[model samples]
Target: MSFPHVTIEGYPRVGANRELKKALEAYWAGKIDEAAFTSTAHSLRIDTYRRLRDLGLTEDYAIPADVAYYDQVLETALTVGVLQAGTLDEEFTLCRGNADTAPLEMTKWFDTNYHYLVPEVADQAFEPNPERILTIVREAADADVKVRPFLVGPVTLLALAKGENPLARLDELVDAYAAVLAALAADGVEWVQVAEPALVADLVPADAELAALAGTAWTKLLNVDNRPNVLITTPYGSLREGLKALADAQPEALHVSLAPSVLAEDPTYVDRVLEAVHPETTLVAGLIDGHNVWAANLRERAEILDKLQAGHPDVAVSTSVSLLHVPHTVTAESNIPVDVAGWLAFADEKITEAVALANRDEDAFARADRAVRTRAESERTRNAEVAARVAKLPEGQVQREPQFEGRKEAQAELGLPKLPTTTIGSFPQTQEIRKARADHRAGTITDAQYTEAMKNEVAEVVKLQEDLGLDVLVHGEPERNDMVQYFSEQMDGFISTDNGWVQSYGSRCVRPPIVIGDVSRPEAMTVEWAKYAQSLTDKPVKGMLTGPVTILAWSFKRDDVPVSVSADQIALALADEVADLEEAGIDIIQIDEPALRELLPLRKDARPEYLDWSIRSFRLVAVDAEPTTQIHTHLCYSEFGEIIDAVAALDADVTSIEAARSKMELLTDLNEGFHSDIGPGVWDIHSPRVPSVDELTELLTAALKHVPAERLWVNPDCGLKTRGYAETNESLKNLVEARDRVVASL
Candidate 1:
């Protein structure tokens, strides 16, 4: 039973035990030296390659040794020597910008939750540092694994970057890439995976022109002396417009994702791709899902592969994209029910499934079939009462009584200042704050001691805000581990793990809670914290809660039921929490739905259903507020151009969005049609640089041209949980001063 050749597009770099994140954080915190950090990272890379070899993938079938210092995009920049300097401090500052340096812009990685540092191109001849890629290849070869080096394609790299006419510098970048490719071939590497994910996105005329130029550049690279075989891989969506350009490039191989793309739903999409692909090229059919945690349906996947192989016997099997998006394995999850656990597949299990599919292993297919059946039965009987409650939800449960004007009049009685300033929830989870929580968890300190420490911290933060002349104050979230995990910890039907960490960004990780059954709040999640913070200040305190949509998006939700059902249950629980906070005499509540736009479907035709349920879940929690309660929601890491109408329909009295990165360019869509009040963030909190008062004033002035002065609120882009205390203080002071200036001008 010889199988078609199988390969992994890329493997997760956050070590099986998350050693990379631990090492990086320790080095950043000054707990470990650079030598120690590099040793740990290098050991993890060796271990990863050895583990893959043990899994029976070797020789030509082995995956390339693709490890990142932080993110793959940032790795690409380092490999190409794109930064001004190659020092460690310069690299760190490039990703996490300092006071004197502006960090590269960050965005969601092509419809996935992972964030990537966008490359910044300038007027310089880019040079290639083949040492990084060459070092990994040599390390993997030492472990007896033949590897193909991976690089982010030049076109995708340029398309995702910020600068003036980045495409104009394509020829120089291509030359650098060709040099790297030739070096890999010199090092005995036979194949290289050049990922061009931008090809899968919807391309405009400018983008298409860039794609054409990229194709021409790659064609030149293929002709380079001693160049390794190039396999262009595009994942996450269709390459409808860019496929012809890619075909014209005429690489040795091309990989296309079948799931989450047109090939899965429309047969015509496969036919079209086959028609454009060159006859001499080997087509790698991405049959297994890389982004999700579901076990592959091997039987169905085989059917699709059979059809593909019938036309082209050169087709191979692979994962749709990199397996970095999912957890490493579900084998360690002992608390979840066996039936549900059997239905789940993580990164490691997906790799095993891919090999089984390529070999057409009957025993593995039978086991998968049985597990699928068990999961279906388990899902049907798991929560009949909750499902019935969702089915019977009354009409208009998602709509608030009284329109914007009525709510505004009631809210005005609180007497907040014009152009009022507020910090996004959270001050800083400083070392002391984190230690207090860790000590409590380890039973090294008494619960009473922990509570007192948190209370004192809250008091300090409250006084700091008051001294800074802020109109609204937050408790600084000293006790919260994360926005979503905090509420999940207090709720029923959620399971959390000790080492379930997944990389959120460079040196930051999140342990996503698993929702196994019906969700309900056993007690109020945030009322005590909000009440305590309010007790210390005369100014209004915003009760913060992670909205239902964010909770659902961030958590490992139940698969037996639709996500909408889980979202509804969470919403009902939050609606109860909202009522409790209002009864606790809290006048303002902010429900942060930062993931609202991130969860929208990539395909335009499939967006309405998702938008409907997502908006409904938000409304279910927010609409229950009193007229004077002043419900607010915050969104981040999103562009509101296509979803502005849906955002307006959420009916929040006020919506604060991430606008500082694009300099409030997103407000152009809202200026003409949006009716709700807005707080277009006056400063970018993602960067470490403290914005000046003049900078904030300019942003406020820009926002005013869109949102009227009366409808505008002054605030930072997002939560302050990731910032330092000194920077947070300086930024907010500037924000308040900018607000005062704007009021005086009016």
Candidate 2:
């Protein structure tokens, strides 16, 4: 049984896809020419393969084909013509202004906070991506490692494609995928794992299209001549509806998650899965902790495996999902205590755990079992302190200063615009800016040199904003690498990584710092940047900072502390920064807590306390300022309808939310009772697919239906840093034009 056991599931340190992000940014900055950008990307591809081999865990390698202009995997599929394109010339021309150069449309990847390039489908142009797969395999061969490269399965591709009715598109896409697989078989690649992860979504509960897409793709994949063994991966949860279809298709294997939640919910879910799977189909049991930072107990894992073994002795144990969700290594996190470090497992450690389980070395596993037990015992000692802290939370600690009316009265005295337009506080973080900062950190450049470069970037950003006629200008964040990370590095309580990379969305990754101890701001956080920007621009410069909830969400939070406690500590630090920014005469400080939605407790019972603390923390940070300070908060892709009260409780003067692509449905609730000022997005800027003035005009019109036109602040869905300068310029021009047209009509 060459069923080489491997686990893949870990959080990213920084952005979603780091190398690809670097390439795109380099290309945008013209630091390296197009050829050089492409060449460096090729080098990153080689580096990824080498890293996988260096780790010594290779049953599979997630190739960088999906890391592309929009997204790598999906882009490769589109470039090779797996999906059918419709009205391409028209939509392309509308979005990019050039039908000849209409790049594929990319959007957010379902709900998991990642984005992938959309597959452009066209029947006349179908070609197998042989070179991509071959190149990956050759890299593996060069490293002397046997591996299976990953591809987006047809079902998931079909589900995410652009069309009115995605279900109808599945039939043709299946055959396209089959042709691609057949070509791979001809190229002598005998094993591949098609990921059908979307089967775990809430939509899959009722959608039959998911099943049909899976069945069609798998049937074709197996039917290919001399094909590789196919392993269908459905991580996160059991494929509730598509299980039977997946079972019937019955390729070489079926991978199901055995994460803590999955195991606790229903032994029946797995039992049914094992029963439905064909006897020939091997069950790839995900036996390690892939999501959390805790080291897995071999004994606990063994017990779960024993249950699986009771049903089928031939079960293979692996990770719950790809290790791409977790940090790369815990080695460089110097701030975390060594004792705690031993109890935790990052991506690299999870790989070793998967190997031990799969190899069936009971004796070796027993030692790991004992080590985990010892660590757990030590952790048990700290539980009392954690419990004590939770019990001692003061009633006043969770409350804020004053009501919205009082704050608003004070804010009015400061004088700000009614329909104030602002950005989420970022300017183009160019290479020259980053290099100067890096050089300063390394002592190759003086503080004066670095600050001067940043000042120049800020001045340019201010000039751009004045030219564009934006109401509130940002300092362009030239001095900061990341919002949370920059602050974390400056403060004493946090620790960061040299090479710790985590995927944010697509190929853009961020190395979030680890908050290991009590967090306190030793000095002012963003006062210099805020003050300097204010100096350059007469227009109100919005001081930007990631809110407490976001810092907690983005960082590798300590398990020893409740999130509420960590949030408070961060809030205390940010509150100081907020005060300093206010003192510096900065109006419209936008505290972005985008991760607030992401950090919502998965279960309902535990949600209120989270909201109570999360909201109080936001208030703690912002409420201290006078009402006229214009305490703005920006959130994206958040469903705040249910938590409208909590949203109100934040007491922000303004909240810019994502509503453009998602049909402005959030406005329905906001219209009914939302008290605070709100600025819903008029168009999505994240996608390269630009909105037309008419499209945005209609969107703004709809936005005006819920929000008063006087209060409306037209802006893009999120930051435009990732977008090309050309696209950004064109899109903003359209947005401003649409706003003007709407205002004229009103």
Candidate 3:
């Protein structure tokens, strides 16, 4: 049952110990020199390869050295000279846009949590950067470890890129890639993994033409003299028509994901792939799950492999995708319950599972079975009261009273300004705020002292908003660590870890709370802060809570329950909090659901059911609010084209979305008869840049074309927790002034 080969597609970018994140941040903040940062990255690269070697994965199989300076896509851009200027500062600007410059467009990395900077291909010439690739190869060589170099395939890079005729320069880009391949061969490398995930996406005729162009590029790359054996890896979903296009490239091997693909649901999908692939090419069966925390059912995986091996006899085994999505290891977690820990597998454990499956180790399969059985018997999987409550829920519990017109009439009683202005819930979490929370956690500050510090911050934020003439105010959220994690800490049935950090974006990591059992709120999580902040201002303060769907989307929930069931429990908990806030005289409540779109199922067929329950969960939280009270929900970094129907079904009084980065392009999708009041963001808050009043006015004017001026609100794309006070103040001031001008014209 043993396969001829075993290889990992790639490893995580965050170092095994997160040394790279700390090093990169320190380097950017001018706390360290370039030499120190390079040394740290080099050491991490060497350590990664050495660890893989020590774990019995040799260079002939998995080399474990495809590391990124920041992100693989960014590194891919650097490889092919996509940047107009190749300076480090320009590189930084591309990844993190500054005050004067907008960064490259960012999007989800093919159904995974990782985000990649899209390559800007306008008027850029291609050149090979073999020195950068060689540096990592040599670092592995210095450790006496031979390695396989990884590259984002030409087809995928061009497919995910922006600009006119991105694939028009395909020939030149292929030449550059061929030179890189020849250089790798000269350095004594034996294999290269070229990732082409675009093959799994739904492509139109124009995109199919680009895909064919990519195939031509790959053909040229493999034709390079002394080129290494190249394996084309396609993850995320099944490749159908695109597979036929890629077959013309004639690679030495092809790797396809099985876990998230159609193959997992239907074994007959193997036959379809076999028909599409080149008969002579080696087929690498991706068997292990890479995106989830659950351990693979080894027995079931073996049966699936049996079907694939019948058609392709020399099948190699691998993880379904890169293990980068999961955390590094579970062995370091001592506080987690033993039974729950036994049921889980992190990236390190997943690697071992892959190797075991390759070797057909019976003991590993036996252990996996026992862990699955143990989890079934654990009390963490069952909650009688929660189940009973869910079963008895009334049919109309998710619908709010009196519709949008009545709610709008009640909202006018507050006498807010036209084109009302507000932020997306949080102000900048400055160093003083962070330090105060840290001091409180360390037991160095009394409860009274911490409360006073938080109140002072709230007062300052209230004054700042009033000075800017903002129509709405927020409590600044200075005491919270993360939107989801902050509430998870206060609720029952969740576990928080001190060191369970995972990278969200550049230099920013989140410690997602683990939901182990039935979730419920013991008391109001944000009421005290909301009341205190409202007491400081005559202006209406928006009481904020992270939406149930977002809390469930971000956290690692118990595997036994359906995600809908867990989300329902969270919705009920948040429903109680919403009622408490309304009773406390907080008329405006914002439930933020930024992660809703990110959690959509990659397969189109699987999306409707997920969207149905996810929308219901959001509705269950805000359905009971009084018509006089304004209910707001925020969704950021989402593509609203397909799910705008489900979004309208939530029926919040107001929904603020992230649109500034796309310059109101998302408004086109929203023109299809949406029910709620809409607020397309006026400017990007993720960047440190302060938007000028003129720029804000231009964006607001664009929004007016789609939304009635009376129904449109003005705000930033998301929270300002990651920004600074100076920029936040300037941005809000400009935002209010732009709204004022727009209102005057109206």
Q: Which candidate's TM-score is highest? A: 3
Q: Where in model 3 is the C-alpha error above 4 Å?
A: 1-4, 84-90, 97-102, 203-225, 247-249, 260-267, 274-279, 393-398, 557-561, 638-643, 661-663, 687-689, 692-702
What would the per-residue lDDT of candidate 3 be over residues 1-746, giving only the tens digit for each residue? 12237777777667767998999889899999889988998888888877776665763637645678777888877876665446666777888877788787778887666788888788766877877778877878777887777888887887788889777777888888888888888988777788888877654334466566766777777777778788888877777656776766778788888873346444556777777677677788788877677787887778767877777756777888888777777887888777778878877788788888878889999999998787777676667777787777775436788888888898888788778899998888888999999999999999999999999999998988988888889999998888888999998878876566666676666667788788888888999999998998899999999998889878876656678888898988898999999989899999999878877865566788888889888988988888999999998877776677777788899999989988988888884558688888987997788999999999999899989987899999999998998898888889988998988888
lDDT for each residue of candidate 2 in 1-746, tens digit (9 for 90 to 100): 33444544322323224656676566555676768766666666556555655555555532222233334345446534663334423322322335356455545544344555555443334555555556666665675654565677767766666655554656566666676667667766666667777776644324466676667667766776666677777776666657888878877778887876556644577778767877778777877856556677776787778777777746777788766667767775675666657766777777767776766668747767765666546633343443454345455434434566666666665454545566666655666877998899899999888788888888887887777777777887877777778778876556666666666554466576766656777789788888888898777888888899988777777644566777877777788898888888887788888877676653344567788888877877875676567788888755667776667667687788887867788888764446677888876765677789999888888888788865677777777656655676667677777777887788
Could you give candidate 1's per-residue lDDT for residues 457-570 as a string of tens digits? Answer: 999999999999999788889999889999998987677765566777887777788787788777898999899999998999999989998998888766556788888889
Worst 10 residues of 2 by lDDT: 61-70
TM-score of 2: 0.75
What local lDDT score does residue 275 receive in model 3, on the 0 to 100 scale?
73
Q: In terms of lDDT, which candidate is stronger, 1 or 3?
A: 1
Report the lDDT of model 1 for residue 47: 84
What's each prediction's TM-score? Answer: 0.89, 0.75, 0.92
